[model samples]
Target: MASTSSYSSSPCAACKFLRRKCMPDCIFAPYFPPEEPQKFANVHKIFGASNVSKLLNEVPPHQREDAVNSLAYEAEARIKDPVYGCVGAISVLQRQVMRLQKELDATNADLFRYTCNEMPTTQPAGAGIRRINEAAAGASSYPQSSVYYYNPSPWNNDLCGDGYQRGGDNNM
Candidate 1:
């Protein structure tokens, strides 16, 4: 086994991004040391890299949510010039939002299984419900919106119930 002495002493953005304590014996040892300069160059390049426009373009619309959420977190952490603590708070907020979204998705899929008359203990998707329940019961505030409709039923057109079933007076 290779000792970790060399990497811990290097100056790479991975070390910097980790606030320095995550050095040596860490999983990134193999990618560090020899490539420290290259890693620093990549991170510094991000400073000058094109805006998240590339992620916007590259990611499919459905999968873009996470990337957009992460980009927004990066922005709030960096710009908007607030006092020191808010940046950290924004990171926490982003994580909370992502967790809530995941919980919601799991809840919907569980509801789908239940409505379809599948056994509650059915294999595969059923396992996710346990995780969803645990996450909902945890300290974070889970979204209270109804997953009882619009999902599982192919005919349900209301994506968000924000009122645009087939274009109406309130359509925007």
Candidate 2:
């Protein structure tokens, strides 16, 4: 007796799941190789086989690989964290970013304070007296108009004009 049986190589994950022969030109062959059945299994379990098929069919060939990878990652995340999934991961990352930003702001403020404290307070000869005299003369001449006096300080600039003050009794 002679047997006329034929054997073919294993089908891709999709065809294996569907219990059909995998064609050479099947769309799922490239992404879902027969060796990695778990990848397709996860995707199929999360998103149904029919939905996966429809998605693969709708997307262009060039984009199908990325779509498959994205689907697989999302599926795995959903499996691990059923309640929040990727959103939970995103929330954690956002919190980390906010914390880092606050730390950075504090560091910058500290550096500014240190640098301001380290700066010299002494002015050139006659600079301070001349500025005081000029301010007095300007204040006397412009009694009705607001007069501004200049002072060299890192924290506060002596801006006294329009009823506003920097280091005076005015509201500003």
Candidate 3:
């Protein structure tokens, strides 16, 4: 009996979809470039030295110098310009703030766990009570949160919060 079945086994996903030789690291951390040029170059385009040099040359002279100098002063200044703007910088700062906030929250939680409910000295062994408490205290000393409001605080007006006067007085 002649079986007209086209159900043949295909190459592995790494080989077929990624178009690269199926390897362990490539399957896991595919974005990481291969150690040796040839192994990594297997599935990716290879740019010649001349092409890369040409691209470098195409960069503006000031930019090229800045890159070489390890001081991107002009680039930093451009980030503040209204025309160039700072959307990217602001996003990066936001991400950094979020990361710091997470760290702060984790430290505060550890501190509260060690101090608020239980006596300080009797905390479980290796609780890092002292260090966590110190870190939380330090973080609380700084006012890092940003609030933008034309009128006044969005929260209760009577309480004296950051950027607000005491006793619910706006004039103060």
Candidate 4:
């Protein structure tokens, strides 16, 4: 909001553009100071002075500043893109957010894979042996090496030389 005291000597942007005397109680004076002539020009060009005054008068004083700023921003956006304006900017931002979200999900999946790979293979008695389910861990996110076919029985020496258990259940 512009200071009315500062605009006392010179006419406000609205008054200056309209070529009218800027009264002390001018409604546009507080929002449109003499320093920013283009601000009022764009707003007035988009929404007429009469309509703006009526709107400002009808709106609550506490909300007048927000209304004025919104009008200015919308007016500038409309000038830039007459078809979509602020909606175009919002659409572009929304698309960027969606793209970033997908990228984040892929990165998280890779991190989960790396963390699981680096984990210690040994587990406590109650915890049981870690085994990958073909239905669950066979997704592309989990590499083929993650699939386990081990029988963690102490008496069973059926494991291969490289410590990889095999033979019984095979899901190709």
lDDT against the true structure, per candidate, is 0.44, 0.63, 0.37, 0.72
Ordered list by lDDT, greatest first: 4, 2, 1, 3
TM-score of each: 0.24, 0.60, 0.23, 0.67
- Clashes, model 3: 1
Instruction: List where candidate 4 sits over 4 angstroms from the true fold.
Output: 6-8, 123-172
Model 4: number of backbone collisions: 0
For TM-score, candidate 1 versus 4, the one ahead is 4
Q: Which parts of model 3 have CA positions greater than 4 angstroms off?
A: 1-85, 120-172
Model 3, residue 62: what's the lDDT? 45
**Better by TM-score, candidate 4 or 3:** 4
Judged by lDDT against the true structure, how good is candidate 4? 0.72
Number of clashing pairs, model 1? 0
How badly does each model clash, as a count of residue pairs?
0, 0, 1, 0
The superposed Cα distance between candidate 2 and the true structure at residue 95, in angstroms, equals 1.3
Cα lDDT over the full model 1 = 0.44
lDDT of 3: 0.37
Per-residue C-alpha lDDT of model 2 across residues 1-172, encoded as one tens digit per residue: 1111221577887778778888876767778877778888889889988899899999997899899999888888889888887888889999998887656555544443443343345634433312222233223232334433333333333322122334433333
Q: Which pairs clash inside model 1?
A: none
TM-score of 2: 0.60
RMSD of each: 19.2, 15.4, 19.2, 13.7
Query: What is candidate 3's lDDT per residue for 90-135, written digit by digit as tens?
Result: 7788999888765655554444444443334555554222323233
Please say which candidate is ahead in lDDT: 1 or 4: 4
lDDT of 4 at 25: 86
lDDT tens digits by residue: candidate 4, 44-151: 989989999999999999899999999999999989988898899899999998887656555544443444464445633323333343454334443466555333
